[model samples]
Target: MATSSICRRRSLSPRRHLTTSPASFILLPLFSKKRTMWCYQNDRCKDNFKKSFRLLKGCASERLSALVVVLLLAIVSYTLYEVQYKTGIEIVPFLPIDDSGFETYNEKLLNDVVTSKAAQNQLPRGSLMCWVMTTSIYHKTRVNAVNSTWLPRCDSSHILTNSPRFLDDQIPYHTVFNSLPESYYKLFWKTRLALLYVYQNVSSEFDWYFKADDDTYVIVDNLRKYLARFDPEKPYFIGYRLKRRMPNNGYNAGGSGYAMSRAAMRIFAEKLFHDKSLCPYHEWEDYAIARCLASMNIYPLDSRDELGRQRFLPWRPEQHFHADLTPSFLMDPIQFWGPSIFHENLVSMHHLKPDEMRLIDGLLYGVSQGIWKPQKAPNSSTSLVNSTEASPMEDTIQPPTVSF
Candidate 1:
């Protein structure tokens, strides 16, 4: 059996039980991560397919039976050939790619949703356009709760789904007419495509961009005030920082949500999107976006309060506040449960039920108590608060001195 140890570092309150980076860390789940498991991806199953084919052939040697058997075998062989020989085509069963040789929705109609409206003209100075990644299944459930609760507070918000029927519902959704199937693993693609669309169409409208999930409950006013000190002109990526395979820095955790400056959004759309090596596909949505941002020298910044209490939490209030917690093997291993106390200026939290979101609305007592607004440090003029290693976005991405 393998051995593991929980090393608690010195801190005031609840501290980490283990010290491991996300790159080499994820462990202890009784079940392993799900595989795409395409039919052609498994070679061992080919023998079973061959056995079945032989039995079916023996069922009848009649001319019609033989013709049907030959047709089926040819189709199978051709599918295998396509998978093995073609590098461009991917047959991910869960996320079906649209190969109709055309875009799904009318581009003009889709762009018209936000193309004409200027966020800067209508909203506050530091306008934030929040994009919530959701699906058709949760269109009515979680999305409705989010819209009814905190989403309205945002300067502008839109639902990102492949479903085009949002037009019929008269909801302000930025639907990309594509055949991308809705699946948990496909979030990376959804996030990337949404940013690209926003950049191409309405980049000039918003000062900052915030992305979240259907279950995420964001204190919009808190987030807007928290990021007010940082110049949106300078690239800022702040959220629940998760240290992944990268050497020095980490990416913001996706569930709790992440905020990016106007500059960061432009850099990602223009520079990172064109380069495959710099912004390649990855399994996790947050990690993939972080990889792209990191290449452009925009890393996740510390979004904690002055006392080092996190502003972004990956779990609900009860999970963090609960005493006598039982350890679990299935829980996400990358959580940074510092001090076990909720910060007064917390901006976001994940894994919330619809009612829980409403419950949080009623309990906004601590939101404005001690907001961490970045200001002139003791002796610094422009240096940001809690950002010892962060710098403004450069003309070109600086290669990290060291990386995985």
Candidate 2:
């Protein structure tokens, strides 16, 4: 009985110890609060770090992209600038060299020509007169030939003068030595003369001007008549169409005839004067003209008939006309010589031989006589001749056959 009582007391003592422990309750609540606070702080720090990392990454990407774009734009701009400023070099003969020095005759001539001369020179009304300037070597054979044949046939009013020569005897040794490929030196002299002519004379006297080779044959009347049909108020540059596939560097099949408007001439002349270094010394005159025109946004015009045939195609022998050789008949010939029929009627016919001239004259006389003598109704063949007035396609008519 005594052992049992001791065990019961021990059990009751354990129950008493549980009921009296207040320190355990306080310490548990404090520990739980501290744990929850630590967890909350750690989560806040993690979220803030993630947001800062994303913002930094976004800023860095945008900056890198902007830098790349700027670099690319800078490279393209520099390349284009270089191309515009670069000048090409070549070799050609210089002009206007005299015993004293470079001939100042061109300057004198330009100064002498007043604005009144241009207005009264039989040029078309409200149209620009362009004087194409060229200098020949003036050798005895060439001068005599030009004087006797070309000048008379073309009926040029300007006189031939020996004011310039294209030799380099007067140039210093250092200049010759520094100018390698020698051809470039000659070309430089020629270009300089041409530019000087433009600066001193062409800009003031004419609305536009062309510089070309002496061998080129121009039907001035035809050119003038054609251009007369178009409105001249807008910016325009016309030249023969070239059929090559390459870009601007190929040979121009259109020959050397190039046209520019008054605006283009003024702009080009101004730019060339200030930036003389931009001129390239080259053999291809047409290319040089084209490049210059392109800088000012000018282009060449295409030549096509109403039926879509090229105007300059090889001529068939079957097509000929009596009136084709006469001036009062077709208006298309006016494109070249402005308002002057003298050039087309008299001068152009001079190139033909005596026999050819006689044939044309006889045809005109016969046609005139036939029309005057005949009395025909509207249905008759003779009336057809009268009905056919001057037309643009007059050059395409077949002529009557005559046995020699």
Candidate 3:
């Protein structure tokens, strides 16, 4: 009904203009008019074309913008799906190696480290000092399990913590960094500050520094045996090496724990942590430290055994044991890692509960030792077969080692 009224008004308006004006009556026969939709005037035709083109252009721009947004969202979603952190998964941050603008390394640098290992001694006597990360919340639970099981095996061990009772407790808890609030986010600062404390106070007393999470269980003797293969005087950051892209190379997983040779500890404790330009404050403690180390040409060292079995595992025993994906995911599981979860003489396993910690200790020390003692064969070398003093599990004897 409204359209009929509009049509009636439109039809009458042209007739009304014609009847009212003698100019329109004379001009109506010319066939071209400026205001009419079908006008063939050059200016009117050009204006109409411009308006139509603008409308079409606006519509196309909107469609293109929507298409771009959808494509961007899809790309981001797929990237997130690929890099999402799962239980015991190694998180690969989408950080370009040049973002830090630190030193870059090549294959030769890694080759040198491997070659240097050949000149080092096996099972050398070295003082291993371990520091564990803990908060007030884990003090009674995970800390106690750590102390009872593996902490004693270290030549000396200190608990790096934020407990209010740091000095009041009889345990050798280091509290130089107790000033910070006990927050997980602040663990990065806690980790760096803890290293500073060890550097200042007791670094001279140890040959190697092993840092671990409180929930991690360490086969300290196996760790000692592993570390003995590298020169303590040379800088080494040894752990479960996560394969990041170029320049970044790799970094030790913070959860599984890592060993720093005395030289590496000294480098970090004395210089790297102080220089924010080289090691800027990052939310990730491991990556920040890694960047600092890499700036000085001290990249992560492969802590795998000769047969390519992993020594430091980021996941707990079951999590690693039942893993289905390769660490890097570009290769088959067996090709990337070994056929099994990890080396039999694994240095550390992380993400354990308080009960699991005690359970692992019992299994390695009591159950396995009691059930599977391998007697020294007549032809066996060094003769420390199934020796508890040698390790919780007997590592195959190295050459030139005499009986204890």
Q: What overall lDDT goes with each candidate model?
A: 0.63, 0.38, 0.64
What pairs collide in candidate 3?
none
> Comparing 2 and 3 by TM-score, which wins?
3
Q: What is the number of residue pairs that collide in model 1?
A: 1
lDDT of model 1, residue 306? 73
Error of 2 at 127 (Å): 3.2
Model 1: how far residue 169 lies from native, Å? 5.4
Kindly give the number of clashing pairs for every candidate. Answer: 1, 23, 0
- In angstroms, the error of model 1 at 251 is 0.8
- Kindly report which residue stretches of model 2 are placed more than 4 angstroms away from their true locations once superposed: 1-196, 202-205, 208-212, 231-233, 243-256, 276-279, 308-404
Candidate 3, residues 194-248, lDDT tens digits: the string is: 6766655545557898899988999998998888878889999988776543234
Q: Is candidate 1 or candidate 3 better by lDDT?
A: 3
Task: Name the top TM-score candidate.
Answer: 3
Q: What stretches of model 3 exceed 4 Å from their correct place?
A: 1-126, 164-168, 245-248, 325-339, 371-404
Against the true structure, candidate 3 reaches a TM-score of 0.58
Residue 39 in model 1: shift from native, Å? Answer: 46
Model 2, residue 125: distance off in Å is: 10
Best-fitting candidate, scored by lDDT: 3
Tell how far residue 235 is off in model 1, in angstroms: 1.1
Provide the lDDT at 219 for model 3.
94
